[model samples]
Target: MINTKKIWYLLAAMAVILITTVALMSNKKEVEKTPKNPYQAIDGAKTNSYEPVGESLELTTDDNVIGNKKAELIVFVYEDYSSPYSAVLAETLSRINSELDNKLTIAIRPFVTAGNNISREGALTLMCAQDEGKFSEMRNVILAAAKEGSLQEGGFNVYANQLGIDETAFNNCLTNEEKSLKLEAIMAEADKNLVIGAPTIFIANEMIIGARPYSDFVDSNGDAVEGLKAVVDRQLSAVGTKK
Candidate 1:
């Protein structure tokens, strides 16, 4: 009787131990198999991404004459000379402006997107033009020359001559330390704006990355007068609501 009792007690203890072990194993499996959020996974995947340089400079259309002063729509494009997409979009933007007839204003900010060398030189050239008060003309000439792949054909001197810019003054502007610092500032602004790619355009606050289709630049779908009326009404409403 004593031996049988001892045997029964041993079996009960063994069963309890076995049950506890199984429960622990099951709990571990459950924890390991639990799913994670898909959005979180995606965010983790994109953690290494970065923006371009020279994105911070506040772009303005005040210098440009194409767009309305109070126009709700403002388009900002970040471009680099080495980028083919930037070249194509530049041409397209020009056409859009002509077709729209001052309805849209495009503000351009130069950034080096492709690589360090081309972007640096391109930014410097733009700054030099700005210094000489020939920014618009020089910008057009460079874009045209870049499209034709003839920027280096005449070097800086020949290109300056073609644009009717004084070669000596232009060369001095390019080599000036002050002008170079300004260009660097522009690049730093671009970096701050988180511009990751070339031809990144912002229509109002809406960000459009890359060379978008021409249809993206079309006028509002609503009646033009209706849109204008809405804006006017909102402004008047705000005025009336002010304390």
Candidate 2:
């Protein structure tokens, strides 16, 4: 005896299950297609929270630096000039180096992001400024321009005279293809390290992304400045403890 009603009920249930499975997989694909973050400048001095990504990343150095080349600790900064957080981190590291008697060796790895002309040009300007031995000063100049939202107006020239670099020379370097190509290589390096944002700091293979309070890095009120002072102190202490 063929049970017609039972067979029809079983077919309907299987169809429903199949439809639900397909719907679920389609939604999963959509979610995977979306980005977890929006590409935009971080608010001035405010940073997103990040967990330590472990000590597996490798970094490189640049001639543009702030502390002892042979310092026990080397901090590699993968930064985009137009990022407000990157500028703040720069100032924070400078303060840390000064406090530590310039014991921290800082390396700058330029990360030029797509669709950010200001950052691209700002980096180029800083490289040109580095040629005349005023890398830090001109970096501040470019950072100031970024803060004022005037990087696109060729505002790096605002500090050209201060460094004794001719306006024409600065402009030429700012638009130089050779320097532009060099920055491209550096950006590739950032990609090699899996860096996806500005102001990512690498210390002893450990990395912290975005901006963090200076206090978080060392001791005192976490309300002061933005950077990774704690990483340097902690690593130095660990080395001491090992000794």
Per-residue error at 106 for model 1, in Å?
Answer: 1.6
Query: Could you tell me how far off, in angstroms, the CA of residue 215 lies in candidate 1 after the best superposition?
Result: 3.8
Candidate 1: stretches off by over 4 Å: 1-70, 216-243
Cα-lDDT of candidate 1: 0.59
The positional error of residue 138 in candidate 1, measured at the CA in angstroms, is: 1.3
> On residues 1-243, what C-alpha lDDT tens digit does candidate 1 reach at each position?
469989999999999999999999999999999865211111211222123233333445323323554544556677776566777777776666565565555677777754456556666677776766777786777777677776552265565687777878877876789867765665666566666668776543234456654442333453212122222233334444763
TM-score of each: 0.59, 0.73
Structure candidate 2, residue pairs in collision: 55-205, 217-230
Give the per-residue lDDT of model 2 (tens digit) for 1-243.
879999999999999999999999999999999877533323332334233433354434454666898787778887788887887888788888899898887888777778877777777878888888888888777776666666664666767887799998888888888888888887776776668888887765456677655774432545433346666677667666876
